[model samples]
Target: MAAPRSVEPADLSPLAWRLLRVAADYEQRTVEREIDDILQAHISMLENGSRALSPSRCNTLFALYSAELTEEQIRAIAENF
Candidate 1:
């Protein structure tokens, strides 16, 4: 199996989590199924100290989540340290 994504507790802010939750809700998706993937990817990026979210990926995620967030908001979450 591939290595698990590393994550730091502090790297994820409540606001970001809330946004993610809202996104999941908008899609009528369970957190376990959809939102978790994005959260895990973010956690991995945070732990690795890598800024690796591409616009295409963000768009795909937003579409999956049915999130109404703007590109700036998504970028902010991904760029947050």
Candidate 2:
């Protein structure tokens, strides 16, 4: 099989963007801290400690955002990550 394509913040769908915004808001509220930049926070999380999003983190993020994402989109996320 060919190598998976990279998933950039720009490549994300509007639903993906909404998921990031919600996740950022959820973290800020639960942690009692503000995320000055939601998009940056998401990028950091996706790139956490590596050039790519770790599988575990990707699964976790997918689960967290699954409520707002379609299965096809989640599958796309899996493929990208």
Candidate 2, RMSD to the unseen true structure: 9.4
Collision count of model 1: 0
RMSD values for the candidates in order, in angstroms, are 10.8, 9.4
For 15-46, candidate 2 gives per-residue lDDT tens digits of 55345536434542432233222344454444
Off by over 4 Å in 1: 1-18, 26-39, 43-52, 67-81
Clashes of each: 0, 0
Each prediction's TM-score versus the true structure: 0.32, 0.32
Candidate 1: tens digits of C-alpha lDDT, residues 1-81: 211123222344445544654644542234325544455646345334464445454445445533455555444564572
- Poorest 10 consecutive residues of model 2 by lDDT? 28-37
Model 2 clashing residue pairs (backbone): none
